[model samples]
Target chain A: MKLWEQNIRKVKPYVPGLQPKEDNIIKLNTNENPYPPAPGVERVMEQMKLDKLRLYPDYDSTELVNELAKEKRVDPEQIFIGVGSDDVLGMAFLTYFNSDKPVLFPDITYSFYDVWCELYKIPYERPMLDENFRIVKQDYYKENGGVVIANPNAPTSICESTEFIRDILEHNQDVVVIVDEAYVDFGGASSIDLLKEYDNLLVVQTFSKSRSLAGLRIGYAIGNKELIEALNIVKFSYNSYTMNTASIVLGAEAVRDKEYFQNTVNQIIEQREKTIQELDELGFTCLDSKANFVFATHKSVPAGKIYEELQKKKIYVRYFNKPRINNFLRITIGTEEEMNQLIIALGEIL
Target chain B: MKLWEQNIRKVKPYVPGLQPKEDNIIKLNTNENPYPPAPGVERVMEQMKLDKLRLYPDYDSTELVNELAKEKRVDPEQIFIGVGSDDVLGMAFLTYFNSDKPVLFPDITYSFYDVWCELYKIPYERPMLDENFRIVKQDYYKENGGVVIANPNAPTSICESTEFIRDILEHNQDVVVIVDEAYVDFGGASSIDLLKEYDNLLVVQTFSKSRSLAGLRIGYAIGNKELIEALNIVKFSYNSYTMNTASIVLGAEAVRDKEYFQNTVNQIIEQREKTIQELDELGFTCLDSKANFVFATHKSVPAGKIYEELQKKKIYVRYFNKPRINNFLRITIGTEEEMNQLIIALGEIL
Candidate 1:
């Protein structure tokens, strides 16, 4: 090995879903919202002054944070914005997961959790999810450095109740508990209300799923002022200007049109219900999902074969080959016509 | 103390230059270009499809990276992109400075170097610059984990020759050497050509200063394929989509208009030389600067008082209150008209 190689920090990186370059394909893999962002976002983009590109963006991201604070009904001091929720969660892991005791999460949850632990050298343990793919609240009740729960968990497409979250929080009050609500807008209940009682609880959300601004890369966290201040300190230490000019201005527009935001989220939820019914009739068993996606397994056909067969028909869905969940496929809810096409494609594959 | 607070990664953040909110002020603190970005950037923004923002950006940032590789005459595999030069440098510190041995840099270089070291818990030593505020190349010849040098070092506005950089690289062949050329396009000689001989060398540059896209937050690193690969791994591990869609698309357009980039850079150089001449006549001893800024100290008045006086006249310039540089004001070069106003204001204050 080269002598300089000894100083290299090695770790496996998280592989985001395939974004096929080809235009004509059904892309339901990454859980991105099928609809475009709010109309106000388009208006903001059109009217944005390109001459301002010469100046550095506001390092504080005041406009976006103020808009979010007003929308979420939290003080501006309670919020911390980042490039995305992934960035927010990554910063949280760096800031809050420094103890020697292993941080706790479910064995089957967002795959990025463990990757972050490895990158920061934070000891972490994943307790197994129940057979129903539910986040067993008791598993996180033990003494640990910290706890992270992905409500409306990915791949499993299951969201635990607010009471379940409270149970975990009540037990782990000594450590920071991060509730990743990336999909809460679709159907999952938010733990944000619990923030009134727990200072250690951090509720993280994103623009990628419900708001349809994944391409813009905006996300934020709402918590106690002290917790947010700590996150800001670490963030500024890392990069003072994570948000850009267009993101700050356009993201504020996304927050302004509340009616358009609700309408798009409602459409996704309605389509999700209809898609689930069709999958059930096709000899497929799907978990009860409160997210923008569905997790289903055919009674006879292996998910790997079904995934490949659907790909042949220009339909894409996420299929993780990890242990215990190999039989399942996570399909994001697309438009009405797209969902019909997906149903037809699934029937043929089965 | 709160139990959860114990795990907080506490460190003093690197405070960025002031970005005043009020308009019509002579903003010259952050080293930003007075001119706008390339015309192609404006065209790209006008024609961008808002609907495509529903999908995630290309994780590889293929288009921007490919364009940059072609422009720099390097392979696509030899480049890494980030939000800004600060983000690129911070990632480099995390990826390459993992050895137990201390990293080496000049004491009077970019202020963010020590903050990054503290954030990552990396042992680092700042070898003091000579009395003239110039990096002594031999000081980096000692055994250390890595070396970083800012060509045309910030606040000091002093540029070192390519031969000086090559001398440091020759001795530190076994460790990674990062030549931060954030201000190189103005006049400083880039050490990018030395990448051919040193496998461990990484050259980082930014669009904020030369390309006039600070508001968009675009930066990149060019180096050996292995070194670039390591940076990509760490970037992906931290945030898979650090570059958003607008940044990727608009950054490519900025690179396409090479003539506009060169024209703007030439204008800034011309303004810088003129400003230095004016400052000299005003009883200020200005450093010989190759950057878009000039570091000058008044013959009688202190830098802090001069900074305050400029601000009172709505002319904002950077003043560092730290050791040695306490009496020097780093003044960014604005347009000719703005510089004339600044000279008039300084003449009155002195």
Candidate 2:
């Protein structure tokens, strides 16, 4: 019955965090920024002329790219837009990794990375994270194809230094290295600045995090023009209108409004720190997170039990039953009010 | 260099029509419908909350599918959504056609059909159309792994009767018979009704034409639940967040307002008949078109010369320099005012 490629058969689908329909829960499973996007960001959608929706979206997303180029301090030619960071990552897998060259990513990083590798039928190796659930950058440099690292890594909520990312780029000369900075807006140092020095490097970012455009499915990759061209070629071959017009417009606006962005991100950071502190004080060993989420566990309690018990109190957080982090829960940093609700629920569950 | 597949090297990169910078140029290329979308469509966009732009669009498009199902008189489960008809076609090619069975499409059909075959390394046979540029459905009963036909076929704008399509579906029980109905909303009858009798038939339609939401990228398929399941699997494995929020809302509204759609199509049909009469009298031989476009050429002049001549007057039409069709220009039918301008320009040129 599995007429699909061998890769799809062995694949484990990406499990996005649980979203509860009823509004009473303190939901923080998917690492979505609890802080709402900039008010100015929504203005772009409001301003769209629905009368013009009949025509095809501006093919190149010219204005959005221009905004991105100015925001990233990179050439417009160096940016590739996609539906989401996953779309950009999918483009990276198709464009950069051939069947002969195996792509590489951390075993414990974003689950979609593995799904993409499978879908593309590219061979890949996952270098295991250390006992502390941190990437060994030196380990990735040995005998790898393309390299990908999630900064403020998912499920672990830990960040690898830009210096280490550059080291991987330096070592992997033959293949493209993709750094997914989806959560980087939370606090992680972006490697976007390094695009000037490296042609083989692509830094993938999303407006879903800090810009709060997760609903709109807008993500982009900043790289050398040649690499960006590869993504464009793949995208053109498949879906030309990858990003919706309204989403692209809002993304450009959010990137342009630096003041609004700073204010919201500052609020999220402040909340994340307090949440992590509260969890730590309750005898949980929490990872030092640069993301708006925390991964933590206690020696006395099983992670799944805690996840379920918290759900009983109308509070939800992520619990991955995967290897290397089965005992921990990845909790999104919500607003102060939501975090307080989660903390109180956690205390009760304990 | 084409890195992955040897077949990719053979593909001529796609060049989409350049976007119109000035609004008044009588844009007719790419077969885009000339009129703007319905008034109801605009109302939905204006009413959408800008804050919703940040969140991911509904992946299932449950609401849209329900409305589409209601309109089509089919079960909601039978509806499969994709980015556009092109994306749906790409998925169909990838899913049904693989190593063992090559696809069979008409030689003069949609160009992307062949491109995807090459990209996926799926061997395909392009059966040449008959003397009148009409597809003989009997030709598909050969060794075709699958059959894809663009109804109210592109470039020619010629349509195959529902009876002829049913004959193909009735006989080709072993293969996937795909109807690319990207232009069906304009005039041609849809094969959606045939789904009850044929489990293997997949009919793909887009909101780009009738709904006038090309900028939004919404396409859907109606088929047996089994075939829908196959496409759904491919979709989930690839991009789940394919349909953004704006598209879902706009597409559903566009489908719901069938009366508005009928009015628009009737106007286009009226304009089309007038344009055809005008061209025929002006010593041009045009294909019998059932869709919203006219495929025409003057016996005295080649298509290339006409294309060049029209460019001088700022009139745009699609010309493919391929065999058999090199003499004809695919001119999308415009609004009454737009078509009058085209006629006036043609009168001056003549």
Candidate 3:
């Protein structure tokens, strides 16, 4: 080994879902929105003056924060923006998970959580989720550095109630609590309201899912002013200009077209329900899902076999080979036509 | 005080140059390029399919990296991209500066160096620059954790020779050495050629300065394949999708138009020389700058008064009120017309 290699930080980086380069395939592995961004995004992209790119974007991301504040019904000071929810959560991990105690999260949650912990060298513990893949709030009540909960957790599609979050917050008031709401807009209840009472609560949401701008890369957190301030301090210390010009301007445009945002989200929800019903008829046990995805296991067929068969037909879905989740498939809800194709592929595979 | 505040990572964040909200003012506080990005950038932005935004961008930033690799004449595996040079540098610090020993840098180098050290809790020592504000190469020859040199060092606008970088690299073979070339395209000789000899050296450059795409937020590092991999691992562990779609696409287009890139750099360099001569005539002592900006201090007038007087005339230049460099103004080279106006304004102020 090279002598300098000793100083190199060794880390097992998070593996994001496949973004298949081949076109005309049903691509639903990464839980990205299956619809285009709001119409205003295109307009803004077309009309934005290219000359202004010579200057750096506003490091504060003032306009984007103001629009998000209006949408979330929070003070502008309560909002903090990042490149995406991953960036936001990474910053949160660095900023708030500094105690000697290990931070706590569900054993099965957004995989990036522990990756952030490991990257920052922050000690963390994973409290196992119940057999139903639901967060056991009481488990988080134990003393810890902090807590992170992915509301409408990934690969499980289960969302807990605000009261459940409050229970944990009440016991863990001494540490910061991050409610990752990346999928909360997809029918799950948001814990943003809890911020009024819990100064330690930080609710992180992203435009990647409901807003259909994952490619644009915008995510934000809303919390009490102090929590947001701390997050901002960490962000500025890291990179003052994290948000680029297109993201700041186009992200606000995506937030502005409220009607289109709701329409696309509603369409995804409708299709999700239909797809879940079809899967059930095919003898697949699907978790009752609130997010824009479903977690399922076939009664007779092995998930690995079914995943292979579907992929052979150009239908993609997420399958984790890890413990407890090895037999399950996490399928992001696509458009009506795409969902139909996925259902038909699964039926044939079974 | 709040109990959770103890867990909050308190930091003195880096204050970026003021991005005034109001328009029609000459902006030079930030050393951003005055010219628009290559014309092809606008074409790409206009032609990009907005519908594809529902999906995530290529986290690897493959196309941009490939384009940059061809431009820089390096293997694709030797390159790593980030949101900007700051993000790139921040990741480098977290990845390569993990040794227990203190990192070494110039006392009056890029301000963000110390900020990153503080944020990441990396021990670092700033060796005092010579009285002429040039890096004393001997100081870095001593044992330390790692080394970071901002070629064409900021605020001082002095570019050390490739030989100077080689000397430092020859001594620090046991640790990673980061040569930040954020301003290299202006005139500075890049340490990229030395990479063939020094496996531990990593050279970072950005599109923000000479390419006139500061608003798009693209930066990269070229090094041995192993060092790039380590940087990528830390980047992926931190935020997998730091480079958004617009930045990736538009940044590639900027690279493709080599003619426009060189033209803009030449224009800025010409303007910088004329600005320096004009400032010298106005009784200002200007550094022998190889950067797009000039570091100048008035012989009789204080930098603060000149900064305020220029502001009153709707012209802005950077004036840092820190020790040792308190009386200097770092004026970015703008258009010839802008420089003339600046010279006229200085004449009147004097």
Per-model TM-score versus the true fold: 0.99, 0.95, 0.99
Better of 2 and 3 by TM-score: 3
TM-score of chain B of each: 0.99, 0.95, 0.99
* Docking quality (DockQ) of candidate 2: 0.46
Write candidate 2's Cα lDDT for B1-350 as tens digits: 42222211233445677576775577888677777888888788878877666556677888899999998899888999887777788877777775466678899977788778766667888888999999977788776577888998987898898998998877777778899998887778899888888878899998888777887888889988877877777677777777777788888888888888888889888999999999998889888888889999986867798787787778888889989999898898888887888888877776
Error of 1 at A95 (Å): 0.6
The lDDT values for all models are 0.92, 0.80, 0.91
Sorted by lDDT, highest first, which candidate order results? Answer: 1, 3, 2
**DockQ preference between candidates 1 and 3, better one:** 1
- DockQ head-to-head 1 vs 2, winner: 1
- Which digits, one per residue and each the tens of the lDDT, describe model 3 over residues B47-122? 9999978889999899999999999999999999998899999999999998889999998989999999999999
Q: What does the i-RMS of model 3 come to?
A: 0.8
Give residue A68's error in model 3 in angstroms: 1.1
Off by over 4 Å in 2: A1-12, B1-11
Two-chain DockQ for each candidate model? 0.89, 0.46, 0.88
B1-350 in candidate 1: lDDT tens per residue? 89989999989999998898998899989999999888888888989999989889998899999999989999999999999998999999999999989999998889999999999999999999999998888889899999999998987889999999999999998899999999999988998899999999999999899989999999999999999999999998989999999999999989999899889889899888889988999999998899999999998999999999999999999999999999999999999999999999999999
- The regions of model 3 sitting more than 4 angstroms off are none
Backbone collision count in every prediction? 0, 7, 0
Candidate 2 collision pairs:
A213-B54, A214-B54, A214-B55, A214-B56, A215-B54, A215-B55, A215-B56
Q: Which pairs clash in the backbone of model 3?
A: none
